[model samples]
Target: MPGRVQGKVAVITGGASGIGRATGFLFGEHGAIVVIADIDKEAAIETAKEINSLGALAIGVGLDVTKESDIKDVFESAAKEFGTISILVNSAGLNPRLPSLAGKTSEEIWDKVIDVNLKGTYLACKNVVDIMAKGGGGSIINLSSIMGMVGYNSVMSNGLSPYNPSKAGVLLLTKNLAVALAPKNIRVNCLNPGFVETPFTETLTSDAELYDNLVKLHPIGRFARPEEIAYCALFLASDESSFVTGAPLLVDGGYTAQ
Candidate 1:
């Protein structure tokens, strides 16, 4: 169990915080050489250092997933250092409530969310395919959301937020890549997590009224911990899930089931 991903190299975008950071720690604990890539350079480095202090091998790199060059550099550098890029966790994403979107036009908000959530995942997968094929196979774990499988409650959303659509796009992208890369032995899958207590959901979770309402949506009556989702990503990353591909594994606390 300790070395489930032994000797594999995993590059996780948005590894500075939230689900990404949790996944990084979990993968490292399982013996993967972790590459923490985040738009926040300082935070990424700090996370890497923390992981290293925990006796795991990790390197932090600044990455803006929206930039093709950044993705190229991270993949190339990781490959050069570790010799093979085996796991990719596309955790870099943006939601409508991101603080940076304050005062931005609706169009701008949509564009940014889509670019980071949907397009960023695409770029990472696109750049890593060849590398993985050369290494004889790998796993790609995309972070979709419950919204991808179901519409937002009309009371909470006007049905125009790009967040839902972007996640939905990830589902299809994962499937397409799974089929296309099947021959290469590369496995592609996604995780549709329900509301987890992460910075990404800060706006809603921090609101007492809103938080209670959201929790009620999940039959479990509570949100997930970051490690819960990380464990699912670990299963997909490890050979234990070799036969699973193009699957959207929902860690939604029965949110979608309802």
Candidate 2:
């Protein structure tokens, strides 16, 4: 009757709102000592409070995915307070309007998107892996999107690209880390979600036609709830996936089936 992640210490990047917040809450629900790390300090504290309300240990840290100092401080504190980092959710990423292969998007847009989505993920994984390795073994889950697995659309009318390739990069990063960390018993994986109704996509929710179209696109006939994606992440980060690594688990509600 033990919870799947009992006694585990998990640090989630971008754990203020959207999927990150939901995952933090659920991870605690399942017995993880949750650390909600985010750039938005106020929101992170609020999220930490919510987790504590659930009778689980929780803390919030001000962190920026682009900053090594922040990652170091958080990991050090987490290691000291919550014990070793047994779970990591690299959910910190951005969705900037980018350009296409040609002269489509602006240089600034592409840089920001790649910096936050790819570089950000790299930093978190790089910092956490050492902690996990020292802890013996752990699970690392990176967030990718359906756009990464396939070209969903043109990121820009002029040629800007946004999420497609960045997510694709995440997909591969997950696999690479899995292989590299396998010798140490650490598991690395990715979660690819399609059109989930979370704060990250709340702006799009107002467009009825767009929302309806998104629903129709999924074979399941609905966008996923944040908790649904959290469930998939939970499985990957827990012993439930003891034999799973270097795998990209699709929580797209069958959007890729088409």
Candidate 3:
């Protein structure tokens, strides 16, 4: 039996950890040639090695999606290596919760978050359009969040969090690109996930009080698993979603239903 994405090449940014890493593994398992591009070179390589060991074709590359050269190089090289890139998962992103941004000022935090979360997505989408179009069309899955659709509660942040704004930008960007690139045969969509249990949320989840509060917001009584979200990405990447485009598929555990 052929896997859903058999023989297709999927280039995933932020493929070293969290949702990105899980998606890479799922894509590989389903027979796609995965390219794990991330800021952590070694982690990315390790991920690719693991996928290959599982009998999938994959390669890992260090990437800083904020840089156009990095995006160009990774996408082009992946196309060159795999013959063509038919799928792209712009999963690279930043949130105020990142420990690296701990001591940074508000301005610095805002800039960094927006750069990686929004601009990086823009750059990756811009660079991959040509390759996907040339390949006769492909699916692009951007990772947005429930925050992208609605404002966060005051308890989360005095409303100064750049995370929400950056993700909100991603939702609109997905829509714009979907409209502009439809004729080119490329399908663009975004996944607005709710809280997911991944390293990315370790900091907050480690605090029992905060974790409980956050979990209650979901209405499902818990956060999502990384693989659950990856399953959604799989559908978008596969031909089963041929008629889906310019959509924001919410896999947010009824968080937005309230």
lDDT of 2 by residue, 35-99 (tens): 99998988999999989998988998889888888999999899988679999998987775212
**Candidate 1 lDDT, 1-258, residue by residue in tens:** 559999899999999999999999999999999999999999999999999999999999999999999999999999998998999999998898889899999999999999999999999999999999999999999999989989998756887899999999999999999999999999999999999999989999889998999999999999999999999999999999999999999999999886
The sequence of per-residue lDDT tens digits that candidate 3 reaches over residues 127-239 is 99999998999999999999999999777898889999999999999999999998998999999999999888999899999999999999888999999999999999999
Off by over 4 Å in 2: 97-105, 154-159
Per-model lDDT: 0.95, 0.86, 0.94
Better of 1 and 3 by lDDT: 1
TM-score of each: 0.99, 0.93, 0.99
Q: In candidate 3, which residue ranges exceed 4 Å CA deviation? A: none
* Model 1 spans with C-alpha error above 4 angstroms: none
In model 3, state the lDDT of residue 151: 96
Candidate 1, run of 10 with poorest lDDT? 153-162
Q: What is candidate 1's CA lDDT for residue 5? A: 95
Error of 1 at 18 (Å): 0.4
Return the TM-score for candidate 2, rounded to 2 decimals.
0.93
TM for candidate 1 is: 0.99
